[model samples]
Every structure is written in structure tokens, then in C-alpha cells.
Target chain A: MTGVRLYFRYLGVSFRSQLQYPASFIMMTVGHLVVTAIEFFGLWALFDRFGSLGDWALAEVALFYGMVHVAFAIAEAAARGFDVLHRHVRTGDFDRILLRPRSTVLQVMGLEFQLMRIGRFTQGFVVLIWGISKVGIVWTLPKYLLMALSILGGCFLFVGLFVLQAVLSFWSVDSLEVVNLTTYGGVETAKVPIAIYKGWFRRFFTWIIPLATINYFPLMAVLDHQDPLNTPLWLSWLSPFFGIAFFTMSLQVWKMGLKYYHSTGS
Target chain B: MAQIVVRDLTKVFKVAHRKAGVWQAIKGLVKREYNPVRALDGVSFEVGRGELVGYLGPNGAGKSTTVKILSGILVPDSGLCKIINRIPWQERAAHVQDIGVVFGQRSQLWWDLPVMDSFELLRDIYRLGPVDFNDTLEELVETLNLSAFLGVPVRQLSLGQRMRCELTASLLHRPKLLFLDEPTIGLDAVSKLVVRDFIKRLNKEHGTTILLTTHDMDDVEALCHRVMIIGRGQILMEGKLKDIRQRFARERRFIVELGNRYVEEEVKGRISKAELIYLEGNQAHFNFDPTIVTPAELLHELSAEFEVRDVLIENPPIDEVIARLYEELAI
Candidate 1:
């Protein structure tokens, strides 16, 4: 069987086991939806009071929020194993993974499939549709394609961050708060327009971490809006590729960490 | 030909040194000391195909470290090691495809999933086809008697039951080589026997090369034909079980139960070339070399002097032999 088929099999087993506790599953899913909804409502109230933040309006900011959450939800669900990799490392379950015949990354990816994250995704989906309706952007085949690519790129970016966090477990089993600062902090920061942040913070997100590549730049291309910070339109369209690049780079770091684990026996 | 050959395999670990107290902890954050521990110091051994070799050692004697390196989960700092003609750490995926490992302390089975579900997932992980998987699964289930709790979740099962399922899970792939790291640890007599029996059959029937690392002497006596003793990160002794017994079996024990109360003078006068190791009201224990005086002569001498009501002649227990060996080697 192909790796993809095997991954789905893992997903099937994981989901079935999780479903064994129907009450807990339902409660967690609803709780996740409620918490995320409250967060969005807080943003909605801020937009209601301010009307517009500089050049960005409520709908434009909603587009950014929706894209980031949707991508984050999908990545968090699919890459749930990497998100909690410290537990596996600390408990020595990672040794079992190394014993398998499959690729470590693929096996780790298949370790979990958080079905409850569907609640978060659903909220993001509803908000995205509402934002599209309110923004009044004319729908076209190319525009829709760009939007799909942007969402996928955003998912890859978050997954990359998760993979990086997991790789750190090889060196230290403690779950560092710094990684959360980047991952959770990235999502909260990216939900707002990049132009509103300080110049250094904006540049850091753009060049170092590339959080803007998935949301801000792709949104600019989709909305046909000029960059408020005066960047080229073509560069904005290329932002989605940065997500793929970041993901690929993170994988190399993961490989190095695996090598370190093998030699050090940590 | 040997199925596994490890020569001069050495691994040194840099363990961080952490001192107690808030000031030391603060200092550790800035600059920490690392002490080098030689987990495997030029260890070397070999196991032929279809051979059940017992790898024995006391705690921190590098038994688990050797198993990890042999199974490809760890890489040695120096020396050559090969399993089935493949360098384990170099071609780990391919090497591990034909190998299975079980760590007694850790469960590879899913905690919340049924035993059957974990088996099915393992089937998929190993990519076994439907017909072949069914055939192998049926044989393992029947042999290991996993039908009773196949539907039960692993967390709910008893330790013995979970261990049986764990054994079955590892063999579903029908790996040519199996590494059992203390497979019978913390098991009752019945569960230990069941596991040992299954492992014996698996080795005989499937011709799987089995390397068992265990602290349980009974496990070694029951399952292994050949035994390797390791001490201080090195192979101290490697030979057949019978050879070890013969090497350490020079002294024999005799327990003679006297009809009347024990007499020290009578016991001393009759038993020559034998030291009375222990004495009670009516029973006396003697340690004597069989070569010096045969059991018949010793029995005759004791009976002729003292009114011996019963005589029990036995060899020392395997644990004593192992303990003595460890002490002598200063491991």
C-alpha cells in the first residue's frame, strides 16, 4: 500500500479510538467551538468600535483572521502528533516509532488525527464565507484558485512550525514556551493587517518567519489591493510559495534532530 | 554463519550533571558540566540464525544499550555491527523491516484501542496484504490465545493479558529477527511460562533469530540454549548454558536431616573435605566439591556417623552463580 493509504488507515484507527468516548469527544468539540467563537466575537466588537484600522476595514481583517484560523485548524488536526511530541519523547514511545519500517515523519504524522478540531475549522469556514460576502470581491476561477492555494500554504506553514517544535524534543523533552510564542503568537499576530504592526515586527514576520506570506500577501493578491507598505504586486502573489519553502526547510532540521537522537541515544 | 555480528561496538554518552540547590541550578543554566559515560565499551558478540541467545546483565551493565544498537534505534560511536548483512543504523528502514523489538516496560499497543484494532493497525503499518495478514494473524492469535481479549482495550487488560497481546503484535509481521528486552519482567508464573512457551515455539517454528535481554534467571534457564553475560559495558562471558553450569558447578550442596538434635562434634568428625555452611536443630548443610568426594561417599560418611533421616543433594541456584559471577567481575 502507498504511504497515503497507510496514513488514512492510521487516521481511521485513531478516529475510531477517539470516538469510543462519545461524551468527551462531543464536549471537547463544543468547547473548542465556543472558545474560538468568543475570540472572534472579541475581534468583532473591536471592529465595531473602530470601524476601520488605518486602511484595513472589518471585512479585510476578517479575511486575514479566517485564513489563519482555517489553516491553523487543519494543520493542528493533521499534525497533532508533532504538536504533542514531547510526551512521546519523554515516555520513550518515539523508540517504537523508530522500529517501524516507514518514514519517521510520515509515521509521526499518522500518530494522531484530532477530529475535534473540526469545530475550529467550521467556525473559520463560516467566517470566511461571511467575509467574502461582505467584502464584495468579484469571484473568478483564478481568484478562487489563489484563495485555495493560500489556505493550503497557510496549513503548511503552521505544520512547519509544529514540526519545528517537535524536533526540539530530541534535544530537550521539556515543552518550551518560546515555541508557543511563535506558533500561537504567530496566529494572533497574523490575524491583523501586517502594515499596522511596528516596522521591525512586520519585517520579522515577512522575512524571518514568513507568517505574512500565507495570509497578508495572498489576501492582497486575491483582493487586488495594493500593499499599504508599498511592496510589488508580483511579490505578494509569490507569498504562498514561502509556506512550502518553510515546510521543506523545517523537515531538514527534523532530519538533523533525528540524527542527533540516534547518535546521542536521548 | 552468524545472523548478527557485532565487533568492538562502543558508545559513549555525554550525560549532563545537574547539582541541587537554587544557586547551582542558576549556575547550571549558564554553564553545565557533562560527564562522559561509556555505555558500551568495545562490546562484541555473535548470534547464529534460529539461535535463542540470552543476554544477561545487572542494571546499568549496558544490556539495553546493546539491544538498542543491535536493533538500529541507536548508533554506536565506534566499531562495526551488522544484522542480516546490513549496517543497522545506515539502512535502518530496510533492516528494521525484517526485525521486531519488544521493550517490557513500554507497550507498543495503542492504549485506548482494542487488541484486535492494534493488530490491524500494525498490519497496515507493516503493509501486510489481506490474505497473508489474515493467515499470520490467525496463527498468532491461536497460538498466543489472544481470542479471549482481542476485543478488549489494552488499558483495561491485566498486565499478563496485555503482554500476550504485545507479543502477538510484534510477530504479526513475521519478522526474521526478534529482540525481546526483558520480555517476562513483572509477570506472574503462569504469564511468564506462557510468554516463554510462545517465544520458544516462535523460534522453533519460524526459525526467527531471538536475542533476549532479561534479569529473570528462570527465563534464561527456560528459553535460552546459549547465554552471554555482559559486565561493565563489555562481554564478560559467552557460551552455552550447560557450559556455564559446568564452569560454575564445581561445588555441590548437601542437606542432611538428622533424626535427633544436631551434634557439632559428630558432624565435624564424619564430614571431611566438606564445610558445614549452615546448621539448625536437626538439619545440617554442607558445601563440598564433587571431585573431592562423590555424593555416595559423602552420604555414606554422614549416615555412618549421624542418624541421617533424610538427605537432599542439589546444585547451587543459577541466580547464585550469576551473582557470584557479577561479584567476581566487579560489575
Candidate 2:
């Protein structure tokens, strides 16, 4: 309970510290807003010209895009510390985390909750509301529950991905950039419908990284149709749970990394 | 039964090999080589309750490795270690709750936050009660004289002010044991004295057992009850500063200042026991063993022959004692 409370306190402190430089904070927030706006426009233009990707409409694609960015922005703010672990390990600042009496997971999570990432979040939120309004689907308690669960599951998945990326810093700091394929690459793939991709790509997202479980499976359950791969409704509904399972597994790897770090004493 | 105990604590590190030049770097990438360096070799020691022990060693001499292990940050390859009756590495969070650590080379406070914010964060990290937290903070802040910069961000403060804040950061939880690794390194004279004074009072008043590792001999002299001199991954010697000095360097010095009427000629000859090490103008330096002949007899004999204006006696400086000890051990 204290860890959760402390995590929020760290967020509060981090927000105030970033406010110390108002100009930089304002500029970066605007940059994030502008950069994400451009990305949305690019996605919007493609749907405007082609009408849709395969059978999926712009409203549905907008839902996919919005859900991905919203969860990503939250994860970006929450996982800023893990995202910058390479620099921390290189500078020997990671030792500071170990010295603290709290769990390393909580310390790293609380390192930063960036306010600028809210710009990206705002854009995603607007698109999401617009997509939901246009979808014309009947509202149900389970559907509402599914939407919230899917977004939260996405957050957990992204946090896990961030932790996985950071785990490599324990052994070697070289070529850690390659792990971006799963983290940043996960974001790119999840923004589009899974059915649009080939069979192997879909399976890779579903099995290897579990990106499909959080975005595609839940979205299909919402649309009331079997995706191109014919995923069952029950499977789609349970897919968000798989994302949570993946989160716990990622933490297991984190444990191994910490043990290796202790033994190395570097 | 001691507050801190260790037996055969050892740690080894593997350093990867990378030679100069771009060609070698690329070739080395394909076939990397590693060299095993033993950082700690069969190092052992114990610190009783409320005992202030100083661990002294040169760079790469395992001073930090030992501190790291004891502070619950690093695990040794093989060792039986316990702090406050708990194995630090096995029960890290709980064990660290009873200890505080500060590394002089690094700042534990948040760079952008004010000093107080960092302290509050630490309070939450340790889950300290508000009353106990504030009590320790009040005492540390007042004693360390950190109220002036308490509101200022850490990066904006001077090194001295920041160091004072760092001390408060570690002690806010009132840990029974404190590990200070070079807590006074690179400070000016006044800051050094303030820090030394604070350390002295903390041990005296709180009975907090402190393990200090520093290059400054003055810190050891002013604070430590006992000292351990480590070199090349092992403890060369450990004892009181005076005892170590007597063992390593028994030869004491005597000085005689001749009156204005006398010249350097009167003080050039050897005395009965002391050796005339140097004769410059009217003052003379004589090296003698205190056991063989006392400074009083040397002064008396010099006064009988020469018109001695003034005389004084002194032991070797602490710096010389450590240097001689290091030399004798060939570390």
C-alpha cells in the first residue's frame, strides 16, 4: 500500500520538478502535441484516401490508433525511468536505486511521470471519444468493462516491455537499441488492425510479444466478429488476462537480472 | 555477537579486454577476452556495538567492495556476513532498514528537487513514522547547519552545502549503523571540520556504530576509535593510530634551538644516545628511541653544553605512520 502511495508521491514531486523550467516544459509539451498530431494526420490521410484497410473502417482504425497511443502515453509517463536505464547503468547511477530500501521496481517506476507525454495522451483521448461515438454499437456493462480492461492490460504490457528492454543493461550496455523492435515496434503494430497483417506477422504479435492479445483480441470482442484468423469470442475476451500474465513473467526476468547484477558487483 | 561480523568474505570481478586501435576493437568484438580480478581475497573483520572503525586503503584495494557487501548492495562470492544479526544480502530490504550509506563521489538526492523533498522521499522509502522522521531531520538539520539551503535545489547548492544535506539524507531514518565512504573527500578546510565535528557528535551522542572509509587521516583521528589499514585486497594491520605508529616507526625526533650567541658548530656533534640527523644554523634535529633515552634527558644534556633558547618534542605525523606502514607492507 505504501509503495503505491509513494509511487504517486514520486509522480507529484516529478511534476513539480519539471515545472521548475517552465519554458522547457511548455516547449516539450507543445512538441509532443505537434509530433503526435502529425502522426494522427498521417493515419487519418491514409484512411481518407483508401476508405479503409481491408474491411476495417477509419472509425475502427481510429479506435485502434487511439487506444494504442493512450495506453502508450500512460506507459511512457510511468516507465520513463526504465526507458532511460541504459544511460543510468552506463553512468553508475543505478547504484543509487540499489541502495534505497524500497523494491527496485517501485523506485524505477517512480523515477519519473513525465507531464509532457500528456500531450500525446490528449490526442489519443480525443480520437477515442470520436471513434466510440461513430461506431454505433450497443453499450453493455461487459463492453464497458472490456474497454477499461483492454486499456489497462495494454499499460501492463507496455510496462513489461519497458522492463524487458532495461534488463539487458545488467550484462552489457552495447546494442541495447535493438530491443526497440519489441517496445517501439510493439506500438507501431498495435495501432493497426491485426487482421490486416499476414498470418505469420499476426501469430508473432499474438504469441511472441503478445501485442495482439491486448489490442486485437479485445477490439474484436468489441466489434462482435471473428478476426481474419477466426479467433473465438471467449479467447478474445480472455486475451487481456494474457497481457497481465506476460507482465508477471517479465518481472521474473527482472529478478534474474538483479541477481546477476549482485553477483557481478560492477 | 558483534554489531557487524564477517568471515572469509571474498569477491572476484571479470574485466573484459579491449585494446587500442579501431582494427583491434573490431577484431576483439569477434573474439573477446576476459581477465579475472580478485577484488576481495579472504578479508575478515568484526565491529562491536557503537564502535567507530575506519577502513583505509588505496584505490582498487577493496575498500569499496567490502563496504558494498556490508551495506547490502553487493554479494560476495563466499562469506559469512551479518549486520545487526541479519545477513545483509539475504534480507536486503529489512537489513538496509537498519543502516544508512553515503558515497562521497555521488549525490543520492534528486538533482532537480529541493533538499527537503529528497528527504521526504527517503522517509517514504524507509516507511518511517512522521514523528520519528521529523525528530531525526530536525536534529540533523540543526546540527549539520543545513537550514539555509534546505529550500534550494540540490544542483544549485555548493558542494559543501550539498554534502551537509547528503549527511541529513542518510541519517533521517536514524539507522543504528552508518557506512560513510569518503564522506569528507574534496571538501575545503572549514567544510571538512564541520563534517568531522558532526561525525564526532553523532557517535558520541547517539552511540551509532560508524564504518568510515576515507583518505583523510584527520577524519580517522578525530572520529574513529579503531582503524583498519587494508591493502591489495587484504587487511595489512588494524589497531589504534598511536599503537600502529609506535609499531611501524619507533624512532622519535628531538629538536634544540641554540641562543643567538651560539653558532651551528656547537650542535653538530653526536649525543650519548640520540643521532644528530641535521644541523642547520642554530637549531638541531636528533633521532632517538624513546625507550632507550627520554626527551627530558636529551633536553637536559643539550642545555648543559649549549646555550639552548627553546626546545620541543613531538611524535611522527599520522600521514607518515600510514606511509611507512604501506611501505613496510609493500602494498
Candidate 3:
């Protein structure tokens, strides 16, 4: 079988094992939906009190929030194995992956598929539809395609960050709070317009990490808005490609990490 | 031809050193101290194809390190290792495709999935064709008797049952080489016998070259004709099992149960070239050099002296031989 087909087979087994505890799965899913709903409500209350922040209206901020949360949810569901890779390394389970005749990345990618994240994904989708309706922008075919591309790009970016986190386990099997600063903290910062941040902060996400390429620039292109930072309009249209590049780079780093892997003692 | 050749392989580990107090832990964060320990020091050995070689060593003797390097999970610091003419760590994927490893302390099967589910996943991972997979699975199932619990989840199975399934899982690809690290470490006598029998048969029938690291002497004695003893990261002895025993088999133990209590002096005067090591109410133990006095001569003298109700003769245990070897070699 091909790697892709084997990946799906691993995912199928993971889903079945998780569903064996139906009650716990349902409870966790409901809990995820409720917590994200309250978080969005808190954002709505702030907007209700202040109408606009830094010249961006509530609907524009909601579009950013919805896009970031939706992409994050998808990445969290698919890349959970990387998110908790320290446990596998510490417990010596990573040795079993080495014994198999497949790429370690493919095996780790298929290690987990968290279906409960669908609850958070649904909430984000609902908020996105509500924001689009309230914004009153004429929706063209290109605009719709751009929006889909932005979500895909954002998912790829977050998954890349998670893969990088797992790669760090080769050197140290600690909790890796530093990588989380980029992943979880990046989600909160990307929910707002990158133009509002200071120059270096915005540049860190734009040039160094390219997180803004997935959401901020693509959103501007789709919303037909001008860059307050004076970036060329053509640059904004090419932002989505950053996700693919980042993902490819992370896979290379993962391969290097495998070479340096010091498997736990038996 | 030799299926595996390891020449002067060595590995050193830099372990962090920290004191117990919280103040020391705080100091460690600034500039940590590291102590270098040699886990494997110029170890070398060879195993021919279809040879079931027993790898023996006490704890902290680098047995597991050798297995990890041979199985391609670790890169040695120096020296050459070639399994089937391929460098293991350099071409890991291709090398591991023909090798199977099982660590008794760890389970390769999925914790929450059924035994057969893990097998099917391995089938996909190894890319075994349907027909080949089925034939191998059927043969292993028959040999290992895994049909009863194939549908049961791994979490609910006992250790023995889980180990049986693990053995079957590793063999599904029909790997030419097998590395078993303490394969029968904590099994009951019956389970150990079953596993040992299966391994012996597998080696004979399929010509699978197996290198087993085990602490169980029975496992070593039952399945291995050739044994390699390693200590302190070096091969101390490697030869046929009987040859090592004969080399160290100098003393014999004799236990005699008397019909009535006897004085120590009375027994001591009757025996020659034999020392009475221990004496209880009606039982006595003797350690005698077989070269000095034959067993028939000693037994005849003992029978003439005491009312010997029972007598048992035994060679010194293998554990004693190994412990003495370790001490004598200072490993």
C-alpha cells in the first residue's frame, strides 16, 4: 500500500479506538464547543462596547478571528501526535517507529486524528458565515476561492509549527513551552489585524515566521483592503504560498531530527 | 556466511550530574556538569546465518546497547557493523526491512487496539502482499496459538498473551534476522517453555538467525547451543555452552540427608578430599573437587559411615559460574 493509504488506515484504527468510549468522546466534544462559544462571546462583548479598534470594525475582526480559529482547530485535530511527542520519546515508544519500514513523519502524522476538534471547527464556521453576511461585501468566485486557500494555508502553517515542536524532541524531551509560544500565542495575535502591532512584532510574523502570509495578507486581498504598512498589493496575493514552503521546510527539519534521534533506554 | 559482523563497535554517553538539593538544581541551570560513561567499549562479535546465539550479561553490561546498535536504532561512536552486507544505521530503512526486534519490557502492539488490528497495520507498514501476509499469519497463528485472543484488545490481555501476540507480529514479515531482548523475562514456567519451544522450532524450520539477550538461565540453556557472555562493555567469553561449563565445572555439590542426627567430627573423619561445608540436624552438604575425589569413591565412604537416607548430586549453578567469571575477570 502507498503511504497515503496506510496513513488513512492508521487514522481509521485511531478513530475506532477513540469511539470505543462514546460517552467520554461526546462529553469532550460538547465541552470544546461550549468553551469556544464563550470565548467568542467575550470578544463580541468587547466589540459591542468599543465599536471599532484601530480603524477595523467588528466584522473585520470577526473575519480574522473565525479564520484563525478554524485553521487552528483543523491543525490541532490532525497534528496532535506532534503536539505530544515528548511522551512518546520519553516512554521509548519512538523506538517502535524506527523498527518499521516507513518514514517516521508519516507514522507520526497518522499517530493521532482528534475528531473532537470538529466541535470547535463548527463554532468557527458559524462565526465565519455570520461575519461574511454582516460585512456586506460582494462575494465573487475568486473571493470565495481566496478564502478557501487562506484556510488551507493557515492549517498548513500551524501543522508546520507542531511538526517543528516534535522535531525538538530529538535534542530534548522536555515540555517545549517555547514552541507553544509561537503556536498558541500566534493564534491569538493573528486574530487581530497585523497592522495594529508594532513594527518589529509585525515583521516577526510577516518576514521571519510568515504567519501573517496565511491569514492577514490573504484576508486583505479577499476583503479588497489596502495595506496600511504600504506593502505592494501583488505581495498580498502571493502570501498563501508561504504555507507550502514552511511545511516543506519543517519536513526537512524532521528528517534531520530523525538522524539525531537518541532513542530512550530500554 | 556470517549474517552479522560487528567489529570494535563503541558508544559513549554524556550523562548530566546533579546534586540532590534545590540549590544545586538551581545552579545546574546556569552551567550543567556532564560525566562521560562508556556504554559500549570496543565490543566485537559475529553470528552466522541460522545461528541462535544467546547474548548474556548482567545489568548495566551494555547488552541492550549492543542490541540497539545491531537493530539499527542507534549509531555507534566508532567501529564497523554490517548485517547482511549492509551498514545498519546508514541505510536504516533497507536494513530494518529484513530484521525484527522485540523488547520484553516494552510492547510494540497498540495499547487500545485488537491484536489482529495491529497485525493488519504492520502488514500495511511492511507492504506485504495479501497472499504472503495471509500465509505468514496463518503459520504464525498455528505455531504461536494466537487465534483465541486475536479479537481481544491488548490492554485487557495478560503479559504472556500479549507477548505471544508480539512474537507473531514481529514474524509476520518473515524477517531473516530476529533480535529478542529479554523475550522471556517475566513469564511463568509453562509460558517460558512454550515460547522457548517455539523459538527453537522457528530457528530449525525457517532458518531464522536469532540473537537473544536474556537474564533467564533456563532460556539460555534451553534454546542456545552457542552463548556469548559480555561484561563491562566487552565480550568476556564466546563459545559453545558445554565448553564454557566444562571449563568452569571444577566443583560438585553433594547433599546427603541422614536418617539420624550425627556429630560433625564423625562425618569429617570418614570423608577424604571433600569438605563438609554445612551440617544441620540430619542433613549435610559437601563441596568437593571432582579431580581430587570421584563421586563413586565419596558415596561409598559416606554410605559406610552414616545411615544415608537420601543423596543428591548437582553441578554448581550457572549463575555462580558467571558471577565468578565476572569477579575473576574484574568486569
Most TM-score-accurate candidate: 1
DockQ metric, candidate 1 = 0.79
Error of 3 at B262 (Å): 3.4
Which pairs of residues have clashing backbones in candidate 3? Answer: none
Clashes of 2: 0
Per-model DockQ? 0.79, 0.60, 0.62
- TM for every model, in the order presented, reads 0.97, 0.92, 0.96
- Worst 10-residue lDDT window for candidate 3 chain A reads A257-266
What is candidate 3's lDDT per residue for B1-331, written digit by digit as tens? Answer: 9999999988888788999998998787677898988988999999999999999988988998899889888888999999999998888889889999989999988878889999999999999999999999999999888899999999999888888898998998999999999989889887898899999999999999999999887788889979998888899899987788777767889999998898889778878768998899999999888888998888888888778899888887888777777777787
Candidates' C-alpha lDDT: 0.89, 0.86, 0.87
Question: Residue B267 deviation, candidate 2, in Å?
Answer: 9.3
Return the TM-score for candidate 2, rounded to 2 decimals: 0.92
The TM-score of the first chain in every model comes to 0.97, 0.96, 0.96
Q: Candidate 3: misplaced stretches above 4 Å?
A: A262-266, B263-270
Query: What are the per-residue Cα lDDT tens digits for candidate 1 across B123-149?
Result: 888888899899998998898888988
- For candidate 3, give the lDDT: 0.87
User: Roughly what TM-score does model 1 have, to 2 decimal places?
Assistant: 0.97
